[model samples]
Target: MTPNPATEPRRFLEHLYNAAVRRALPLHNTAAFLPPPPKGRTIVLGAGKAGGSMAQAVEALWPADAPLEGLVVTRYHHIPPRPERLKSRIEIVEAAHPVPDAAGLAAAQRILAMAHGLTKDDLVLCLISGGGSALLTLPAEGLTLEDKQQINKQLLNSGANISEMNCVRKHLSRIKGGRLAAACAPAKVVTLTISDVPGDDPSIIASGPTVPDATSCAEAIAILQRYGIAVPGAIMSLLEQGALETPKPGDEIFTGHEVHMIATPQQSLEAAAQEARAAGIEAYILSDEMEGESREVGKVHAALARAAAHRGQPFAKPCVILSGGETTVTIRKQPEGTPRGRGGRAGEFCLGLAQALQGQGGVWALAADTDGIDGVEDNAGAFVAPETLSRALSLGMKIDKYLDRNDAYGYFRQLDDLVITGPTHTNVNDFRAMLVL
Candidate 1:
């Protein structure tokens, strides 16, 4: 028997989302990049949303006889369940994300210590992905953890792009921006990364802990100054004196190191596009490197989707428009004694899309983070239907007011539209889809 036609659109959107995620799973993408057993012990060091899964994949694929031991850090509650028969050799730990904590500091210290005294025959396999910057945190000399945390909060709330934020993180860290690779000198380093940043710039992914950094300390200082974030006097002096510089592209420490992009936002978007075309709908991919303010990006997407839905220009009816990449949200200052809004880029984008859509018929949309968590929130994202605005109006929920408060979660929760897929264990940044029929 065939499924009902009325529910096909929603199901197709979900299928596309799943396809995008499946393409990024470590289990599916790690085997090809696995290096052969080295002359000495093989150590794995990693951090990100996909760290646990990447570790497990390495454990499953590596030769059972050769020695394999290491550690990886991931966001809290993101670790996947180990297989029943697979004995764990790699230690998987939990840490804070989008904000560093004591756990991350300890983990970073341990990882650095482990990299010390490695021989040329030893191998270091680094599994990197999105969110590693926060998961593996070690403050540079003279900078306290509290200071780093404050800067992180400020950058996140300042609407800085990922590149800008990471530029600052790389300079202020003791382990990021190829410092980890430098510590493993004499030992070959192999990095298997999942791209979550715009342009898939390896140096920007998790601040490129295992790759050479092309950004400079001077650039980082400029970003901080442009954003009006104050730096300590000592740190400012270090930056001005070029003492906080990261390893450049030709640094000797990266002599035997290599990096492989295992998964990317563009690949995931193409996966979703394949699913759309298989379902007999024309698929259009706008871009996989989109960046900017989340709400503003949503409004722009809404305009494009509306043009197709209303006038059938650029794209025809019965089509799905897809896009990927990371977007930022700058938290607004709340009034005195008012509670801060809850939601991340995905939900916020949905709010903007719903508002701009204006209840146009035959249009449905979904915006979600591929990692299954949007910002610090539990839900991956939210969905929008043609009646979203009208339903909210009926429930006395003002879209503009909620948007002003940056309360996408509150607005969508009341409508029962939040997408709650717990811990996808992989991240390729944001996945957005619009269906017009």
Candidate 2:
């Protein structure tokens, strides 16, 4: 017989997070996922917030006889506490994220150099995960790291979606798209990724270093133009002339390349739903492909949760609504002369939920990033209890004004309700759960 789930709601949430974290552990999944060691030198190279943990995973699985040596770059503070067994072989380098820094630039150059002139006998194992697009910073010729930094900041604030943003990145990069894979010609490359993108397309993940390039220079230019991003004319001309050619599909450069998604957002959401079932709560995953403006999606979620809380239209009460996928914020719409708010999708979703709930007193919810960071803020996400609106009103906080400034993080922080987990060493996008009891 199954035991009763006596844990409180917050505890249950933690249990779900722990379960998801467990599935990500390198010790658990490394053996079966391990690739064969190369006949020659086996070099490791990668980037992303989860790069550190991924490197450790590979080291743990690799035979001691194999020649394993290389470096991985991860977001600052995202590295795991390494065990004695794997720490010495794989070097974990720290880099600035969501923006480029000198260290990241240096790391990118080094990783590029590491792939130089290898025979088919040599092997290159890449541990890629979300944040790699930024963590693996390689500026195009004549472009400074600052230029990349400025553009990256603009892209984040722009309403551009992941694909659009990555398209621009691929064009302006020396290592992204298929450039990195091209650098390691004749040397077989295998990439193991933990996907944070909605569709889990490897070419979209970290801009597909070893994968083919379906997006072209023109597409990148159009994406930049659609968002009103103005780059130098020289850069524009280079793209227009197809000077930046990423390796295309069937480019012989990728014949020996292999890519695999080791984990994904959908998988994480499924883990949460399974836990809900054990608690006797019927769980329905709304969609794993959710995207669009964060606040707007939040409002939509609020309506659904409210309906379930009141008339049980789309779903009955006592059912948990779950979803996964990244939601974006378009800061270009913020009110005039107002600083954008300090939160991400998770917090914004809660704001919309709390506003819609309006003290309804029956629904509870949690939204968070699997990587343990939401947006550009320090918090992963936030939780909304049944009395959230009541508590906010008592504290004299205006949800609409905070929402207007795009300051969802600040609002949640004031209430001491922000979820901060620092780096979970994994990314599968966002995880959301709404329970109506």
Candidate 3:
């Protein structure tokens, strides 16, 4: 008999999540996007949560006789366990994510240096993914690493969307916004990336290090000002003068460059839906380009789940609702004596969902980042059941208070509901599932 989602909701949900992740694995999606070995040496350069896996895929598939060498940097502990028999050809280093660190800065510099002297006959294979913006950090002239880190923190807490944030990042970086591609002038550059941003715009992924940037310095300046995030005075002057502009579309340097999206949020969501269907559950994908405040989105999802459960208006019984895309959480200020809340977008969504659900029967939900890490926290996300609100109440936990402080991590931990999955060596942004039976 098929397992019932009502009886084992968490297990069923996790199975679907795993299926989604497996669909985006580099080993499964990289082969088709791989270019034939060039006449000259093939140099690989990459940075992201999936850098290690992407490198391994190339190493395994490329002709063992052809020359292959370069560097890739991934978030610390994100490298997948190497197959014992597989020989490593690319250098995979570890660094920080969501925030740039000294290690990342060094890695970006090295990756840039590798492209400095490529010939027309050489091929540059760039393995980029979602976290590349933070992992590959080469600051612009006159800017310190400290400046980038501080601005990054402000952007994260500013509730700025991915596009807006990346726009700003492209202007401040020495290697992003098509600068990497510009460096490989006269050489063939092939970029194989996994899409984590909504709409899967190649330029927006990892700040489009290898793709021509359509965003301009003026736009970046406007985004920074709109968010009230200040920058160093010199950088602001450069932006105003258009001295920090990135390579735009139609730039000659990008001639013959190719970008292939190996995996994407929509594909992963479809994979999850297929898994649910195979298990005898009807699944509906709400969207793969969702954005906005995490808590508000959760409330909207709650409304949908309640409607399906009570009236079956939009979707009938025994069905799963799914969504993908990155969401933002604007950190709320705390009183001087109080500690700040800890949690990412996924956790915040759950808190809002649980509160809005009001203990509605026969409803369960799971929200997580496909990369297996939510924000900067250890947990990927969190889960919610019908009794979530009531259980918290029993433990002297008030959902409203937690929501006020954006304390989804604390709230979920108290209920033993936080989803903890170590780095899955891939990223396609957020994954959410709601089961209404």
Candidate 4:
């Protein structure tokens, strides 16, 4: 039975979110993408928010007698609990994300070392998903880990899109942008990935570590210059000299390489739509590729919801509107001695949504990151309801102030509306559902 959205909107939205996540679980989607055991050993090397679960899926599927061993690096605390009887084969390690740390650097170096000495008969299965660009960090020549970290922070804060951020990442890293594929020269490299970006381009997913790169060093430099992000002088020289260029498409090293998108934001959004339909509620998918500033996207969604609620235009009553994609957040500068705002794209989205909703009747919504973390915060995201503004007013809270500071986390936490699902072990990026009755 479907929970009534009028009184149980949170539960209903949570159900839809869970359905979406279940559809993208690595175990549910990895089977067909798995290649046959190679003539030589099958070595798995991977990095992402979903790395732990993807590694576990491989361990569960491959024939017990087959030679399958590898290492995968996942976000800190992201490894799911192993099934009671499942034996561990892949060495799964934890590392920081959205920012690289020493552990991630070490893991990247180790993964690169492991790719060495492979023959043509061997198979290299790379399980990639969102967040790999940050998790698999190996600095380029003359660049230090600290330099990469600062650059990553600058790019992230500059509101650069995933592709742009990754373009810069690929040029500055030793293992990304097809360099990883080049390292495994004689082996057949297969990458099984979950798409989180808007277009599902393999080259942009995790910065295409195992696939050929079509992006150029000049493009990377242009992106950096566009965003006003800087690199070390020597690294800048390499960029100018084209010495930081990734292996381009048609490169001989990627001859036998294959990439398969096992899960994607569209699939997850469709799953949510199906779940809503199964519950006898009409569901409309806006788009799986929605992007732009988080707050602006939220305002647009509010307009649609308001239209549907007021005049039954575009969508009728009792409908759920769904969308999925990685939204960007541009952190606002705060005055000195003032506390920095805390929130991710999901939270900022909700804040804008609530402010624009203006306490319109009969609307409720949820916005969350599929990986269960929002911009380094513990909360996946937050919720919005018709009374959101009124409730805040009652608590002497002003919506515009929070929005000014980009403090959605603080705003939602006061309302006890933050969604706190921890590490779903898979990512197809953002999952949002708006219920208009």
Query: What does candidate 1's lDDT look like per residue over 1-437, in tens digits?
Result: 22222476566677788899999999999999998999898999999999999999999999889999999999999999999988799999999998999999999999999999999999999999999999999999999999999999999899899999999999999999999999998899999999999899999999999999999989999999999888799999999899999999998888867899999999999998887887778899999999888999989988988999879988998888999888999888889999889999999999999999899888889999999998899899999999999999999999998898899999999999998899999999999999888
Cα lDDT of all candidates, in order?
Answer: 0.92, 0.83, 0.94, 0.93
Model 4 alpha-carbon drift over 4 Å, by segment: none
- Candidate 2's residue-wise lDDT over 136-202, tens digit each? 9898887888889989989998978898999999999999998988998889898888888889999
How do these models rank on lDDT, best leading? Answer: 3, 4, 1, 2
* Clashes per candidate, residues 3 or more apart or on different chains: 0, 4, 0, 0
* lDDT of the structure predicted as candidate 1: 0.92
Better of 3 and 4 by lDDT: 3
lDDT of 3 by residue, 128-200 (tens): 9989999999999989999999999999999999999999999999999999999987899999999999999
Q: What is the alpha-carbon lDDT for the whole of candidate 2?
A: 0.83
Instruction: Give model 2's TM-score versus the native structure.
Output: 0.95
For candidate 1, the per-residue lDDT at 308 reads 91
Better of 1 and 2 by lDDT: 1
Tens digit of per-residue lDDT, candidate 4, span 138-251: 999899999999999999899999999999999998999999999988999999999989989989988989887888889988998898998888888899999988998888
Using all chains and alpha carbons, the TM-scores for the candidates as numbered come to 0.98, 0.95, 0.99, 0.99
